[model samples]
Target: MPTYRAPRGTRDLLPTETPTWTRLERLAADLAARYGYRRIETPLFEQTDVFERGIGEVTDVVEKELFRLAPRTEESESWVLRPEPTAGIVRAYVQHGMRTWPQPVKVTQTGPMFRYDRPQAGRYRQFWQFDVEAIGDPGPAVDAEIIELGTRFYREAGLDGVEVLLNSIGDAACRPAYVAELTAYYEPHRVALPAIERGRLDRNVLRLLDSKDPAMAGLNANAPRMTERLCADCAEHFAAVRAHLDALGVGYRLEPGLVRGLDYYTRTAFEFYLVGREGQQQAIGGGGRYDGLVELLGGRPTPAIGFGIGLDRLILALTETAQAVPSEAGPTAVVVGADPDDTIARLRVVTQLRAAGVGSRAELGRRKLGKQLEAAARDGAHFAVILGDELADGNVGLRDLPAGTQKVVALADLAREIERAHAAHRHGGGPD
Candidate 1:
């Protein structure tokens, strides 16, 4: 026999860990609904070109991190597990002709995403995210709305000192000139740059500004800021976004070099970072406007903005901040058989309690009454209904495990008796 464990980059969330995950998912879904965003689910995997075309072939996500699957036959299309949700979501929006339904269709989804990256403290090969997207709207107001949505999620999750870093990377009209100016600024430093940075300088100049290499930091810091080069329309859009944020009482800091990882993103890029932990790896969540993504995915040109909150990093943050992660409450009662042959009677009593709106379970086996009671207590059951010889007399024993007391009640009155005990306990009286 061989002992196997969860694969290198994944871990099983046992009974002890799942309640917190469920709570977070529900919180995200409920908050998104309140904002008028309907739920949308895309497949876990999609046609490879959906990402390659939307995220860009030059990007690391498509070039390196993608978990690409080979085609089953030469005529079959290739596929890959989604490394991010926006591209797939956009694919759905286009495929289903959502543009005809309504303008600026707001939608949200949460699920597992696969990325082939080095697994560290908060990063995982398989992780989960809550995504929100507002499509077919190019106005700055929706941009501000999505940003605030991310901030509110952090606040409601008990996180403190989260700061928003905002930037505008210019749209297609003005971005080429900015990229040209940026390429010129770094021309002299080309020899000093590393192989990867040098390649980025010539291929995707914007990415060099976001590089983590210490050697390129000095050159990147000296590079011209896109905010200074934004065309009139972009500058006005950026200002409007800021005004909306101020009006909503959401504060943010402007970052000149905040071009996000994706190629589809244009204008109004933003990220949520914890104060004193501003590393990219520490970013709680981030997204920006991708006005051209729908067209890139085969739909007519449509404007959209969205964000993804990495839930794995979020859970880690909750633990590190000492915020309480709530656990699932135990059953209200456990029904135990008082005799070896009383299994059927105990099942009936448990079912009756359930019908009366009691959360309950039954202890199976021919164990003695004392053992059964002990098992129920260990399971966090508040009370145990022991079906004894009293069943013939239309009565049974209700034992309060915490109080170490037992009382006899008519079988028909068992549910009412339990309800009253609960009411008494809630009112600060003993469950009698």
Candidate 2:
């Protein structure tokens, strides 16, 4: 026989860790709802072309991280475990004709997404994302609203010291000319660019603007900035987004070199990071404008903006800041000192407690009264109900473990008294 464990880059959230996830989900859901966003669900996998057309061909996700698989049928084409949810959500919107329902469709979802990347601390091959998207709006207010939602989400989740990095990649009209100028600037220093960056020089020159290699970073330091190339329309939109952020009192930094490293994003692109945690590999979450994505995915030209918060990274940030707390665990009630012959009575008590929505556990193995009390304390039980030959005389022993108090109550009034005590204890009104 062999012992098995969860695969690398994956984890099983045990009972002790469930409360963190539960708390985060609740906070995210409440924040999204307050912002007028509804919930949406999509499949875990989709046709390969969906991603190829939706996520850029030159992006790292498509080039290296996608989890590709073939369907069962011989004639069927390949499918991919969705590395992200935006494309799938767009596809659903188009397929369901959601365009006819409203001008801007607001939605959010939380689920597992797969990608084949080297797992490091806070990075995983399979992880959860809390994603929110707004489709069919091209206004700058929409962009600001999405960013605001993301900021509030982090604060609501108890994360502090987070900041936003904002930038505009320019609109379609101004981008081509800027791309040409950028290409020319890098042409002279092309030989100095890193091998990995050189390959993307011609195809995705903007990414070079974000190079981390010391050599490439030096070469790019003098390169022309994207802001210098923004067309009139893109410049106006960028200004409007900034105005909204300022009016709303949201502090942000203008990173001219902030290329989001994604293909579909245009005009507005931004990322959120925790201040003083710059060395952390992953951003807590980020999102930007993807106006052309829906059309590229075979739908109408629907403009949209959204963000995806990495649950793993967010948890890490929370831990580092000492904002996360472990959830308390215990059985609400324990049945103690039941003899083998008194099994029926013990079972009745256990069943009744459960039926009344109380969490109860019983001692099945034969044990002495003292041993039973020790077990109950070890399990963090609130109270112990003793059912033995002594309690067969129409009364039961109710022991309050914490207070060292014990009393005998009529068997008929046992359940009612337990319920009252439990309620009082939960509300902090019970005796010490």
In model 2, the Cα lDDT at residue 159 comes to 84
TM-score winner: 1
The list of candidate 2 runs beyond 4 A from truth reads 1-3, 278-282, 338-341, 429-432
Each model's lDDT: 0.89, 0.85
Clashes of 2: 0
TM-score of every prediction relative to native: 0.94, 0.93
Candidate 1: deviation at residue 243, Å? Answer: 0.7
State the lDDT of candidate 1 residue by residue for 314-407, as single tens digits: 8888878767466456688899976856788888999999999988999878888889888898887778898878889999899988888999
Residue range 193-282, candidate 2, lDDT tens digits: 678788768778888887777877667778888887788888899999999999888889998888876688888988888887666544
Stretches of model 1 off by over 4 angstroms after superposition? 213-217, 278-280, 427-432
Model 1, residue pairs in steric clash? none
